[model samples]
Target: MPVRPLSPELAEKARNELNETDENKMVDSLQHLKDWLAKQPYLKARTDDQWLAAFLRGCKFSLERTKQKIDLFYTLKKTAPELTPLKYKDPKFSEILDLGVSIVLPKTSNPAEPRILLMRPGLYDPNKYSLGDVMSVGAVIQNIMLMDDDNFVVAGGISIIDLQGCTMAHFAQMNPMLMKKMTVAFQEAAPVRMKGVHYLNTPPGFETIFNFIKGFLNEKNKKRLYVHNTDFESLYKYLPKEVLPTEYGGNAGTAREFTENTKKKILEYSAWLDEEHLYGTEESKRPGKPKTAEELFGVEGSFRQLQKVIMIRELSPDLAHIAKTELNEDPKQTPEDIKHLREWIMKQTHLKARTDHQWLVAMLRGCKFSLERVKEKLDLYYTLRTTSPEVTLRLKPTQPTFINFLRLGTCIILPKATTGLHPRVILIRAGRYDPEKNSVADIMCILYYMVQILVMEDDSATVIGTKIVVDYEGTTLNHLVQANVTLLRKIVAVSQDSLPLRLKGSHHLNVPSGIETIFKLVSAFISEKAKQRLKIHKSADELFEHIPKDVMPPEYGGNGATVAENIEYWITKIREYKSWMEVEERLGTDESRRLGSLPSDEAGDKGSFRQLNID
Candidate 1:
């Protein structure tokens, strides 16, 4: 039986479709598109509508599917047109520029020759060219277009390293369009896994696999595509840099060497680019040098002080009233008279709510330092002095805010002043407070309340340096993650009792119970002044003489012990589980063992056991 000759016009049409050099021109024309659509029986079901309607529906669907591919092809042509021009010229991987398939040629080889379309499936870089695979694809198409017949064998190859790490699989997942295009182009394209390339750390696994793709493509335009898993550069180094014309170098042997070198350089440049582009990693920290004054005190500290000064001056009238009418100090400057003056600055402006340093600095500039000078001297004087105020004033502190940072979930920010040594931190939070009863309306508000206790202290770190932390918990419309470090610290002073109890029943009341438990512990702290008064009888008398016996600490009643001693005695009894430390130590080993065996949870829960259970 003899083979039938294809009609000249049909042959020319096939050639145009398979061998045309321009990708844009290669897009099937509208008539050709209609013809192709007429063939798909499943899709043709929807073609019962009028021609225009069917055409519109098909156009919409096809446009959506082909948009990315068309864009990618054109982008490749624009960026690397030189590479596109030579894909079908005796298509073989003799050199780098001739490395990949030229879109101009038919995607497959003829039945007569063993052709392979090598591709390492990967996520598209929008429009990337694999010289090896493209050349292989181009060569196969070239052979087929110029072939005497239609049937041909084609196969793909990927690097063993890529296979090992699942790179091809990941690529397929990211770029399904590329996979679809390649699959639709070659239904009978066989998969050939070759463990032939060793990309051992020269370039990446992908580059080496690419080079092998070229190697397999240029192989005698045979019907069978042979893929080798090997690094092309390593193979390039081992094999002749220049393959002769008889050796598949074709007519442009000299240009091939230049092409190969260019490919290697491209690989290197791509790698360099990859290293330069960083995303989630931390930047390298420079070694330490001398610290600037701002760094030592913290840039935030100055702005914070500036903010305080502003708030203080804004309420100067009230502060002056307190200073003059209450403390008997002149409002105007006279350093001596201004000494030991103390006043609390209430925060009401939304400006104070912002944590940005620039915003704070700008806000600080608006403060009249000249007017605050007297206030400033008084402030500093009060900080260093031991004199107590005649009247305690209530200052409203901002609520603590929590943020979800990447590393930590819902962390309260520790103030900069509270860092770097033995530092002290004040946490602040806000919750609804019942003014009538001077008690928290909600139990959970205590978290904010406890945080507020730390935030409200006037010059809290008088005798010690500790870290200050603030967290804010409020019903924000934004579902805030616990990542923002700056905003988290602002609301630390907020009382836990303020937390919203969305749940019903005992859970709602439990929130406030928890708050009281914490407050009980906090109110137990002895201030430095109180501690000092516990020493020397005269000092104790000076401190206690102003207050009634009922109000005075226990030692002032002549308990044959100072207040500090009495506190220590109580602490010892509570801690040792005996009236005296000596008595606790005298207990036999069995008694000590029993005490040590108590469950930790049970011990702590005892503090609020009744309240927690009742709630």
Candidate 2:
């Protein structure tokens, strides 16, 4: 089918605005870009006229610039498959398409008018589909536009983000990691010209995100951006009723009809979409340099987590301000601290560390930006391998022991994530795994990796601290007997002293048979400071007083997911950080390179098997 027709007047406008040349030059330029793609060792892309022409229009027909953009466009498809996976028709993937949350209204009489993309974020349930899923589906539609929507290519596009039904929960599920990446993808990587962005029914918490979004906008987008907070009349000034859907008071059909039509267009291109997966950049084949997450998002975690930015993303803007105030520091000064730390870290010959803004911010927040403590904590963190290689160095995710212990449903990170000052709750079933099969060291190793991932990704957990709930409901003498005292002491020391997290508060539920003996044994390992924050509860009622039921698992009468569900999620989460862990195995303190002996924390007793306080 031929592409949609743009009016002659609009065609001229597109040419002038997009820096298009005469017809002969346009053809030569198209062929030039196609030839450039054919020559690139790294890129395998669609070079058809429709596909190549859309990119030319988006990038203003600049051959050099379009070549660079084409690289990013395909590179992103390969590097960031999480955003655009191979799942062409997974149930969850299909549901987003069926939901019609992202729609392109049919063209009006003025073919020159830019195509309107109606984005409704609140249409999908946060519980069922994440923001990535929605964005992924939106990307698919945009790709479809390149092939079929001629007006979209020549005349440009506008997005009407209707946030009428959006809630804070929907916002919470959004990955903070996507901020920089999302902006880069849409503004630079994607093959489209976003002329206008209108946000309708803007909510309370969306302002900060909007500010972040606006910072990346070019002058044209900035001028065209519209935020109508439940004011449809104001929107009418730019987008007339004749072009809007019936739901938005337009002469056009209902949103359902627009949705069905757009979906049909996407369905018709399923084979094309399948072939889409084949086109991407093989960075190794690229000339000159390959792009790493470090170059892209700054920090690279196991799963490419943007830890530095996550701190800002995890907290509501209001809470972040409050957190800054408590530290007696200006929010703008955070970069300086991160900068200083990066310089200091690079000077240390014994360390190989990630110096990304997102990662450094999490570290600074954990230490309250105190360089002294930050240095100490970071030193001990890497030195952990030298201090205790048994726990830190050999943590293999693929090992049967790790997987089996993980499947035992022992350690769980509750979905009730820590937001603002609300701590990220980690529930540990102390007696879940058989003591005979695994030593306390092995269990502590698993918990160590879990907490490692938690602190690394969860800036809130590092900033405000984490809430730990250890359930000893099913403990026995055998469990305590196998618990190695020295290894447990190292675990306590590493967490309490080395890690940057506040360690917030620890709650012990259903203490085993000998309460005093257990407390004394535990007290020997933890510092006097951690002792004050420890809360030992005799009953669930007492535990509920400090730790609310709403923030707990469903098995405990909380309004959250069941323990089984949590275990599944936590395991998957741990697995996601496998890349980070494998990288971690190669990175650590080489004591031989140190100028002096680094001080160690070992205050606990070395005796027969006994319990140690895990703070």
Q: Which stretches of candidate 2 lie over 4 Å from their true place?
A: 1-149, 158-192, 195-215, 219-315, 417-421, 602-615
Q: After superposing candidate 1, which stretches have Cα over 4 Å from the reference?
A: 1-174, 180-184, 187-615
Query: Each model's TM-score, in the order given?
Result: 0.17, 0.57
lDDT of 1 by residue, 236-298 (tens): 442232331212222324333533543444344444324322211111221233223234223
Worst 10 residues of 2 by lDDT: 606-615
**Tens digits of per-residue lDDT for model 2, 1-615:** 322344687668766788765666667987898778888888999877778878888888878888888888888876666676526577877788778899999955486777899988888988888777888888888898888887788777888999866765776665555666776788888878877888987754355456556655677777888878778999999889988998887888888998899778878998888887678888898888887655666655532433333233445575577568654445778756876888898999888776645556667777777888788778777777666767664446645567778777777777643332567777888888777776555656776677766655555565567778888878888877764556656767666766666766889987877655766766887777779889988777787776767778777767678888877876766665554566666777777888765644545564211122222
Looking at model 2, the pairs that clash are: 302-580, 308-358, 308-359, 309-358, 522-613
lDDT for position 531 in model 2: 90
Residue 52 displacement in candidate 2 (angstroms): 16
What C-alpha lDDT do the candidate models reach, one value each?
Answer: 0.26, 0.72
lDDT of 2 at 500: 62
